[model samples]
Target: MNHFKIFSTAAATTLLAPAAMAQGIDAKVNEAFATVTGPFVNFIFAPIPGTSFPWIVLWLVAAATIFSIYFGFVQFRFFGHAIRLVKGDYSDPNDAGEVSHFQALATALSGTVGLGNIAGVAVAVGIGGPGATFWMILAGLLGMASKFTECTLGVKFRNEYADGSVSGGPMYYISKGFTQLGLPGGKILAVLFAIFCILGSLGGGNMFQSNQAHAQIANIVGDYPGWITGIVFAAIVYAVIVGGIKSIANVTEKIVPFMGILYVGSALVILIVNYHLIGWAIGQVFAGAFTGLGVAGGMVGALIQGFRRAAFSNEAGVGSAAIAHSAVKTKEPITEGFVSLLEPLIDTVVICTMTALVIIISQQLIMEETSGHYLMNEAGTGIATVGGNTGVALTSAAFGSSISWFPYLLAVAVILFAFSTMISWSYYGLKAWTYLFGEGKTTELLFKIIFCVFVVIGAAASLGPVIDFSDAAIFAMAVVNIAALYPLMKLVKAELDSYSARLKSGEIRAFKH
Candidate 1:
């Protein structure tokens, strides 16, 4: 058999194995995948000379910072305006788009607010220390501008179909926007972006979400075969994506709001109950931010972890949200930009910070008294776990210490989060897939079938090089994406200027009842 067939068969067997051996199978599969994926991870995450920050993090941070300055901190200036746009302030009944601004925001949020918040933050704090939380907030703040720039370009350059369907994203913007500017490398960047997005959609967006979701499920119920969870989840995902079923997507979108609110609310309650240590936790986060110990580069270690996790969680500069926001029903592209800036804020700053605080306040990472609240004697190292686990399990333990039953609810939320995220990413991957393969029923169904099968593979496997490689693929999109952003950002800024001029002059008035 060919490699794909052989690997798929092996994955199927591993996942279907007995529970006692399933976890081992997971590790072995992960190792096998890791052996191949390790080089890519090393290249992507390799530290700078005498520092721990990866070039990818710096690439994204640079884009975010430049845009924040170029737009005069538009993320801040347009903050209120974004809220209004999402509230349909300037919506028209005759608008030509597939979804409303609110729907677009919700859809984008659903894609991003998944395992990264649940498991990624734990990984960050687990290794980089609580100080990582501080830098994550900063990255999220700066990342808003990148979101604004890309989503605006996404809509501005989108291809509106004859049937009112729209396809917009970095691909559209990179190809078309560069063409408009007489730029030489737009097509190259766009094509590269689509390729990475496909890989990312399968790995980080699809498999990583499935893997973590399964892990959370196993945490709750008795340990069953990972393949069992994977197969069931994959079937459900296949049903939603294969038939172009809008109803399932609608149901998912609706359920996501409830799950999200409850999850955040639960985080707040965990904090509120531990009010006594809130300051100490905050102090720990702040202190560790500057002078974190242990780890390779001290302060840089914390910076890297915080920025990496935030970028992964919010996807501000990666251009995925541009696709989701492009579907918003608005004539002006800048409005979508405004609306999208809120994504990273909510995902990384608000929600992610809450998770960090809980982990810190729980004192779960304190290896000793001298380690401080969020600090560890050694930085860049994971703390010892009672269950000898990391990722979502660590997050669960931190919360369970505060609320014993929270794990059950968290499992439900994780599944829901995974479901909604997968559905969103399925659309993302489909767009990229069709971009490369062209649009047709057969082509579409082919991709969906492959996606469903991988979901099973992802859930049945363990976290290691496979997940790392997938995450790297997602960031690889950023490398090409930011290249396009530099040349195309001026177009977005011009749109922002016009939108502001019109709004200030009362020409962009709200719709009257």
Candidate 2:
């Protein structure tokens, strides 16, 4: 066993030597790319005056909110139905698809219920204050409408390849919707969305996940070196991802719920123990939301920040989750749409709220300020550096303050969340890659291999700016996706009407299979 471990390490090092060497070149290229593109992104995403929110987030939130109100807050009315769908009340395994409803939700949740829930929430609370959590949940509630719309289209426009494979997402919807509407540049826009989705899945979804997991493991389990973590993580990720959607589905279905419950349960325990401070924490959230310097920027800024974190976490308008939702074995697209509504609830409303509460309650205890509180640590290297740099650490600190071993548990949860996200995203990128570069077995294998390799690279390297660029790329895809969705609202409405009619007519009785 010792010899085998040594040999495995040696083999991994040899294989990764090229990646290490290539990192320097990749960095230089990335630096040059950033030099050209950085200003544009920053300008485009710049915060609105008098608020912490950015323009991009504001646009997304506005679009989503309009859709929600226009659609009659479908999320609120049909949430129970969505839960039934997720529980397999309407699942048909023999239907045309790669996975079951539960599996598909797990796969999609794997993508959304990830580091964003962990690190992203921390960043929001760190910068926007606990009050940001209130806005985040509000945005999440509206985001459910966006998720329903995009996912319904994802299923409605899905393509079943000759080999019985599935291909769907915003790319398909943009092109198909435009073609259906007889619009010019429909295919071109679809292709653009596909390209962006592919890039995002590669970077934010896969690489970022591996990188964060590597950091957490290294921090907890001695200096095992990032490459070590990367290799192991890559191996496991590749092993599951290479099996295609079924393997990804199987893993996520099991992991997503377990980790989610564990993390939430832990947070609840802490909240209960500090029951006396619940009111104070809630007060801080509201107080900060209305009167802090952060909110003084303007309602628009606050709206943007709240919307940005919500979109980032729930991914309602982003259209990435649509890829996963498309694979569900359902004849009724609206059923899946209803199921997709639960995503933002699980992600933003539930998980993210717990994280925000823990951080807010804990910060109140540690910090001296009662009004206009500010974290002194700007670097986020340790617990002391307060100026909002410590994303995951702040969450960990909050958990640790109550339960001594909670930090380690949270760390493990982060790894699982990140891992599940990477695998699911690998499939999303693969679909996009296959869409662009023919879906031959060889091409598919090539993409998977390259994806696995990047997992290691992301784990080993410092990609602070690269991750940001990738995140922007993901959000950019949403811009195109939501544009397509707005025009195709009738189609979703049609599907919803059809599903409701069927349900009313007893054509589709209580979901048995």
Candidate 3:
């Protein structure tokens, strides 16, 4: 308690400083970070010459594409089964009180369905034009295959504790699956995966969530000192995360569906009101997707933004969801895998597309005359200033234009989404931390404390390089994870084949209505 007060005081002093002063401090931080991490980020996001499509995004897109083909589009074939799993239709009654596929799906969704759906779609449409939505939806569909494979392997190779706890993810799958395949160096690949997951959890999952949450609140409540928000958020999240608590994260899952319903409900209202423009908006999505709508990079730029943001939003190929899904207490490992497919669909296809439509339907694009950057549009009712900003501001403005009070509602929703995301990602990072640092009370506590501190830092600091580094770190996880996937994909295919045969043979028992 004493430590909490002291930490809160320090956060105010450092993070609540004037915006200009904060920018100065953040500038230095970004410079130092850029000098060290710039090359790696550059490599990860390096755009193709004569086009804006980056190599890392291409890597993810290719993987999703390959998996969809290899699985013969299992996401399509088993879509009904996936819904049933999430609905507990196939759940064994004897496993009562244990984690269900819905719980696992909600846990994973809490992480993937946060700011990316809100802010990321705004950025994609802002820069890539409305056509990016088309590609974003496409990527979400294809990425479902990646989700199915990684999650199935996660459960198949998980280490089930005697106490009903579970630990798995790319780290376990890579190490265990590789050895099972008579391949060497599975440990090395797993270690690399663990390293990236830890970094990614810190950057993309924790910092990005807090940073954007602060941004959204400040936009609505006035740009008061960031530390004020930072301190409050850091404390609340710390309590949930520091003790390896799981229920708060589960509680967060309850927030997701409400948030989604409200936001999407509001967007649908706007679409219906502007029914005549829906066709025009969708047309823009297709046109901009293929032609880039006279934008800079043409079709490639649209595809790059769409794919990158969708990957970030749903995290299909990154192998993070596998960690959360591994906890479901199910007789069939593949059942959890099927449930996992719903994440990208709800997150990207349904929610993100709605956000993009709101932005596009608003038809608010303000390109800077001097800097060549598109500023904010409040459905033409307001003007956005030119400066560094995330997509959250633009998203808020669009909804606020229609609903008037939506920004306030959005601010509340953002905080909940961000909090839920941090709690879930904390588990992902902790697993990676334990894989490297060993499991125990002290070790877990140490990592949690460090994670909470970053929450403060993320809320207070300038996020330019931080976001860049965070995005790079998230994509870096894909690099190591996909490496493991190639050698072990055949094994996953065999599992799918075997599971399908048994279900078809009526050898698998499911819950009766």
Q: Write the per-residue lDDT of candidate 1 for residues 263-334, one digit (tens) a residue.
A: 889989988987888888888788878987555446777888898888778888889889877877889999
- Estimate TM-scores for all models: 0.88, 0.88, 0.88
**TM-score, predicted candidate 2 vs. hidden true structure:** 0.88
Candidate 2 residue lDDT tens string, 4-53 = 00011122222222344336765685577667767745654666786555
* Top of the candidates by lDDT: 1
Error of 1 at 71 (Å): 0.5
Location of the lowest summed lDDT over 10 successive residues in candidate 3: 1-10
Backbone collisions counted per model: 3, 14, 2
Lowest summed lDDT window (length 10), candidate 1: 1-10
List candidate 2 stretches off by more than 4 Å.
1-30, 48-52, 293-302, 367-389
RMSD of each predicted structure:
5.0, 6.9, 6.2
Please state the error at residue 76 of candidate 2 in Å.
Answer: 0.8
